[model samples]
Target: MNWPPVPQVDLLEGLHLRYGVLATELRLLSDGLDEAARTFRVGVGNGPDLALRLAAGDPRPVTYFVLLHLRDRGVDAVVAPLPTMTGEAFVRVDGLTWSLYPFFDGADGWTHGMDVQAWHNLGSALRAVHDVPPADAVVPREAFDVTRYDGLTAWNAASR
Candidate 1:
């Protein structure tokens, strides 16, 4: 809660004005000091629930584009962020990046118990994501040099 703090009513109102979503309830779904993002289950009146996330210092715009691409590529497992009235993927509110996604029911593979079909579906999804051409600017590239990793350097020195 301390990381980004709970969103105020005005913020939600702004969300509605910008995205045309009428958020009726905002229930916190993630709670921890170490969490990277504060997630909430948003209840929309007369519509499917949406998941709201507030994260700081994340490259959300690129991520949103990639997710949108993945969904377009027939990856049903991934949920694309809802675009604003201006067609922007994410909005900045009080120094935190806020994005909304269609909340899908069902737990992750770990919790829901992945069967054979589930594994196959997961593999297909991974293939679809990985198959995205690198030419696309939205695809994230390696941000750091692996040779500079302290743990890897230590392991290499110990092995020598």
Candidate 2:
């Protein structure tokens, strides 16, 4: 991503305190780095590594609200971040927002070739995203709801 560099300390602290993930190693997934954000492949000791994205934004709740809305509608197209311990989907540390997601190891679309079916699947996913209704009128009560572990549950229920 075409974004400025962020401190590793800020990233680690946010992940640890917000998501309770104690990462042992933080490696840059250089392939996906763009101007909007910096992507990191976080290694949490013996557990499966997670994906971390550090984007320059001032804590936007609407972003996560829309993401949860789409996922609850059966659109399995987007990668929604795991919410924080306080149920916030995005955490701010040092003027940058960080979010964590379960990492799925796969080929980089830029380098890896795609088959016809893969292309069709991509189109279907995009269509699913487009079909979701807007959430401009809702109060987003679930966006800030607190949960100890299953943070997104409240958001899912609120959307329904």
Candidate 3:
């Protein structure tokens, strides 16, 4: 996969100054223009792993709010955004938006096989997230129309 340009040392230093994230090492986790972000696994000495994301065009404030809400709801599965030294959820460094999160180690179900218990755990997490009360006007909701897939609809009709 095509990865975004790696962050330079100066930018990392800026992150250190702003967020206190001292990156001893960095490993690219994923990149996508659709997501408008590039993620990295930041290694810190004697500290838990951190996920640092550099986003060009994302509604980060809203996203950060939602993550914080989930965390407040006691949903431990979600990776909540870490606050900067100035108590900001995210900061801009070198013209790119940066956010930090606690990294959780887990295999991708798409690449690595998941057992029945794993699936159950995933379902439980999803249920927990759904049980949380919405932020109402704070977060906007998007409607998904499955009927938009004409080919799939026709196939389902024929199969029935």
Candidate 4:
């Protein structure tokens, strides 16, 4: 897929300074058209193929907290963004949020298969994520509490 061009120098420098991994090569793994974020496979100096994503939005602290909590709970399936040197999950560069992910090249897209098992597996994964209770003090209860506006519905009904 044709990904929107990455801000190469800015992103590379951010990753380098934060992670201490000087990546000599960067390749576009996928475009944001399907995932809403561009994924990049970075070839660091004799290390694993690290994955990084550039997302066009503010870094959601609560979401990252939940991810870390899930990881702590032994749900290895949940791909949490790796924290930077100062422990921030995302780095803001050129108005975009760049976050690091462990490269899982085996991940298949939602459209990969059109079968019952695939659909069931997708549903099960979603259910697993929904079922995980937010960790205490990881993401505050206030972050989950939402008051409805004129037309916007707060999705965190269970948290209330």
Per-residue lDDT of model 2, residues 39-157, tens digit only: 89999989998998887766667777778777778888787888889987787776678888888898855688898888998999999988887666434445764566586787789
TM-score of each: 0.74, 0.71, 0.74, 0.68
**How do the residues 15-117 of candidate 3 rate in per-residue lDDT, one tens digit apiece?**
6898887878888776334466777788888999898888775345777888888898999988789999999888876557888888888777777889999
How many backbone clashes can be found in candidate 3? 0
Candidate 4 stretches with Cα past 4 Å from truth are 1-7, 31-36, 107-109, 114-131, 138-160
Candidate 1 deviant stretches above 4 angstroms? 31-34, 58-60, 139-160
Instruction: State the lDDT at 129 in candidate 4.
Output: 76
State which candidate, 2 or 3, has the greater TM-score.
3
Q: Candidate 2 or 4, higher lDDT?
A: 2
Model 1 per-residue lDDT tens digits across residues 4-46 = 5554696579768878887888888743353667777888888
Q: Please state the error at residue 60 of candidate 1 in Å.
A: 4.3
Q: What are the runs in model 3 whose C-alpha is more than 4 Å off?
A: 1-7, 31-35, 140-160
What is the Cα-based lDDT of residue 33 in candidate 1? Answer: 50
- Candidate 3 local accuracy as lDDT? 0.79
Return whichever of 2 and 4 wins on TM-score. Answer: 2
Model 3: worst 10 consecutive residues (lDDT sum): 1-10
Q: List the residue pairs that clash in candidate 4.
A: none
